[model samples]
Each structure stands twice: as C-alpha cells, then as structure tokens.
Target: MITVKAPGKLYIAGEYAVLEPGHPAIIVALDRFITVSVSEATLQGTINSRQYAETDFHWRRSGDQMIFDNRDNPYHYILEAIRVVETLALEMGRPLKIYDLDINSQLEDQGGRKYGLGSSAAVTVATVKALCQFYELPLSRMDFFKLAAIAHFNVQGNGSLGDIAASVFGGWIAYSTFDKDWLRTVLQTNTFGEILASEWPGLKIELLHVPNELELLIGWTGSPASTSRLVDKITIAKFAEHEQYQHFLAESQKCVQKMINGIRNHHLPIVKAEIRHNRQLIKDLGFFSGVTIETPALQELCRIAEDCGGAAKSSGAGGGDCGIVLTDHTVDQARLISAWNQQQITTLPLSVFQLTEASV
Candidate 1:
C-alpha cells in the first residue's frame, strides 16, 4: 500500500479578499491530517472511509475517465483527484491501474463534525499524493500543488485555493491565488503537464517563520459554515457594491502584508495589531455584503480572547466555525481556554504542521 497524508489548514489573516488574484493571505497547516492509502486491485477499485460509514464505493476506468458504480457517490473530491492524476499518468505513457483507496481523517470530531480545518482540501491533496506514489510519479512540491489545485478547483470552482497550498506545503505560508480566468482560458489549448510547468499568473506561495514568543489558539463554535455558499453571496454583493468591495480588498491586502512582515520579523505587536485591523475589515465587509461573516458565537469567542490579551478573529468564510487567536507567551492560556469553555466554545488542541526537508 502506498500511504500519504495531508494537513488541514486555517486562514490566519486573509479571508474574502484573497479570492482576488495577487491578494495575499496568511494560512497555516494544522497537525491534524487526512490520510489516503492505495493498494493494487484487479479490475474494479474500492474507496472506503469510516467517516462515510464503512461502505465501499466502487469504480472502474473507461478510457481515461473514472466512472463510479453509484451515481450519488459522496466522493467528489476523491474522484476528481483520481481523474486528474490518472490523466497525467496516461499522458506520461503510464497505464492506469485499479486500486482500493482507504481514507481516514483527523480533521473532525468523534461525531464526524468538521472543525472547519479545510478537510476537503486535505483529502484532495492526500489522494493526489497517494496516487502519485502508486504510479511512481516523482513530482516536485510545486507540481503536486498544481495538480491538487486543479482537482480542487474542478469541484469547488471558487476561492483562493490557499488551503490547497497549505495542505501541499504543510507549514505557515504566505499564499496568493493564481488567475483562475487565465487557467480557464489556457485549459482549452494546454495539457495538465504543460500548465504545471508554465508560470501561473499571480500565484505565490512562500513558507514563513513564526516568532518564538507568539502563541496561536483556535476556538470552535460547534457550527460548520459552507465556505462556498458564503463566497457566492459575497460575489453577488460585490457587483452591487463594487467600490466598497474594492476598498475592502485593498485594506485587506495591506493588513495581511503587515501581518506577514510581522511574522517574518518576529514582531508580535505588529502581528497583533494587524489581526485586530483585519477583524474590523471583515466586519465592515459583512455589513456591506449583507452576510453575517461573524456569528454571535464567533463574536463572543473573539471578545474572550481580546479580554485575555490577544487578537482574535473569525478564521475562514466565517458564518460559523473556528476563530483564531494570537497572543504572546505571557498571557494565561488556561484562562483563555476556560473563558471560551464558559461560553460553549471549544478550544481545539492543534499546532502548526511544519514541513521537513524530506517532505518538501
């Protein structure tokens, strides 16, 4: 069996604005991961996951496409990963082989509730990595990231794909999205290999170093938000309020850039200040966009963190899910966690998943 794992990601600073090309976001990979294991099979392949109730999903290859036995299968990301990676394999003169894929995830609770830790992106990355190993494809990190991004975009059709980068690189990263419009135009004339080798306009991913004295904390609101739904709403609102939306994007870029510099320079004060500024920017965005980016629970979560001497904000698309906090080591973490618990917020035990030389 060829086994591979990909880490979940949390957006630290940038949220809605990162959707635009060239806009920067600070994201970190969590220690929690989604694992994919692939083993050779005869004719048909099976995909099994306890998270999806232990039932085996069967599939077969027709030419270069993967056709599932069940039309209502819940393996959209997994199937897309297989399709794209197999396409690449066939292009490289390698025949596709049947394999049974086993998937396990740590990005959710015991009840299978997601923590909004980018589980979909992690699973897609893990599947791509597992299949690449199974096919003996020695792809570089950038190539792997591009492949996973393509698979994810085919399903999601929106967002920055910064989560894909975090899952692929596995560390604190400064990420900017590629031009989706350009990719869409190029796909008509280019193969996957050619696109992977070419330069993706406005795409950037750089690993960052965190300050030693800085402490990161995550609080879950026990509610999961659909990032795509929220983003769709924002997209509509953007057309109605184009000027305000542009201003929001500009401010978000500045705030994220400052936060990134703070992380690189080991300046906790600058990072904390930018976090607070970004929080207000998101709030203003929610007001104009007519979407509740931050729920009552998330507001309370951030309040408790601020009262305890930290900067806090909603993590992702932010209707409900997780909020991240950054504080110095001098703060009482136990008190912060206890305060969050009092308000029915669960403080998650997660750390940054750093990349090793071998993994990179």
Candidate 2:
C-alpha cells in the first residue's frame, strides 16, 4: 500500500496580483490535509470514488471501452485530479492501467466545505503523490507541485500556483512571479530548473493544532464566486491606468512585506495589522461587494472578532468559502464557538504545522 498525505494552504499575500508576470505571493501549508492510500485492485470491476456522499462517481474499463458515471459537473476538483493524473501518465509514456480503485476523501468537516484552508490544493497534491507512487516514478516535491498546478488550473480555469507551491514545500515561501526578462533571458539562459534540481533550501515553519484556543468562524454568502473572474477583474482594474487601484496594489504589497516580517519574527501584531490592511485594499477593489463579505453575517462576525480582540478576512477567491480569524493564544475556543453558534456561523479549529525536512 502506498500512503500519501498532502497539506492544505492559506494565501498570506499577493492574491489577485500574483497572476501578473512580475508579482509575488506568500502562502503557508496548514496541518489540515487529505490523505490517499492506494493498493493493487483485487477485484476487476470498476473504479469507484466513495469519498463524497453527495456525489456519485463510477468508471468502468472493459477491453478499451470506458464509461464514466457522474452526477455533477466533474470538472471542479476530484475529477480534475483524476484527469490530470491520467494525462500525466500518458505524458510519461505510460498509459494508466488500473482494474479498479477506491478513493475515500475527508473534507475539513462532514457538513460544509470550509475556507481559509486550501482543500482543493490538498486534494490535488494527494492525487499527484498517489499517482507518482503507483507508477514508481521518482519525483521531487517541486515536480508534484507543477502537476498539482496543472490540476488546479483545470479546475479553477486559472490558478495562482501559490497553494500548490506551499503544500509541496510546506513552509512560508516567497513565490515571486518572474519578470519577463527573468523568465526569458535569465532563467532560460541559465537553466534555472537545473539549478533548482541540484540545490535545495531549508526553511523553518511550525504547524500547530490549537483547537481549543484558536477557534475560527466562517460563513458563506449563499453565492458562488468564480476565481478566474476575480483574477480578470483585478488585472483590468490594476492595469487600467487607475491611480486608486495602483495605490491599493502598492499598499497591499507593502503590507505583505510586513506579514513576511511577522512570520519570520513570530510577531502576531504585525501579522494582524498587515492582514487587516490588505483586507481593506481587497475591499477597495470591489471584490468584496455583493459577495459574502458584504453579508450581514460576515460583517457582524468581523465585528465580533474585533471586539473579542481578533481580526478576520475572507479566505480564497473572496466570493466566500471561509475566513481566517486571528485571536490570542489564550482565547476560549468554546466561547468563540458558542458565540458563532448564536450568530449561526460555523466554527473550525485552526491548525499550525511546522515543516520538517522529511515531511517537506
């Protein structure tokens, strides 16, 4: 049996702008994860994905004839992972040959898909790891990262690549977008990929599961947001020759730099300040409007977090999945949970994981 585990991720900075050529982003892999264990199939029948109860998936292969039984549009995530793996296998000159396989997935919770944690990225990483193991292919973490990025883009149409990078590297990473000159002239000329293949850098990070003290409350806006649309909107707004958005991006970058300091020095105050400031910059871009962040529940929750001596911000793509709440290490998790319950907001216990040499 091959057991593979992948970590979730959180975008610390450079959300929308990271799509640009010369921008950078930062993300941290969380302790939360999705694990896949694969073994040879004993019964030759059909492959079944029994992870999500709400979704039914079945695929059969009989002498080159294949059939896929699915309900929802299988392009979102898990299905995309399967497709990407199949494609990668073919690219490696190995046509996938599996009689049958069973996949069981565990989301953060059984009820709702939570935010702040990158579940999609975790699933993508796990899928890649499982495929690599099954094929007996030797691949570095960065290689898996590249595969996961392909899966992510297939699902979201466009991805920033930060989440996959964080999950694979498992530390705070400075994911700077290379300038055209850097990518074309420097990297291509110097063969940057070869350099990375030869040298590995060591970084320090801690992932903690403080379930009791560090409670997080997340709410949805009852509306789905397209990550690609948000990216396009930000790009147009930032490059439209508008001074206001230009200022916002500049300020956001500065705040992100402060966040980097916070991570390096373990300064909670700096992290909170930078995240709060950056949230405002995102808000100014009009992405937060008419979305979940504009919902009364989210606004009230933000106020509650602030009153309780903490801060909160929308997690991914901002149309709303979840939000991260910063609180004191001594804060009462039960109290926060109870408060959120009263307000009809669901709570999730956050985890902090420290990257190890072996794990990374």
CA lDDT of every candidate: 0.93, 0.59
- Per-candidate alpha-carbon RMSD to the true structure: 1.1, 5.6
Cα distance off (Å), candidate 1, residue 80:
0.4
Q: For residues 256-320, write the lDDT of model 1, one tens digit per residue.
A: 99999999999999999999999999999999999999999999999999999999999989999
| Cα lDDT tens digits for candidate 2, 1-360 | 676777877665567656644455666666777776666653243434545545544556564344565556442565566666665565566656554434454444554544546667787788777877787666776667656665676567555667777777775576744233232243334432343353222222223222233334444333345566766665566556468766666776677767776766677777777767766766666643222333455566666666666767665567655556767675555676667778777665545455676664
Point out the worst 10-residue segment of candidate 2 by lDDT. Answer: 199-208
User: Which pairs of residues have clashing backbones in candidate 2?
Assistant: 205-354, 206-353, 206-354, 207-352, 207-353, 207-354, 208-352, 208-353
For model 1, the local distance difference test gives 0.93
**Candidate 1 deviant stretches above 4 angstroms:** 358-360
Clashes of each: 0, 8
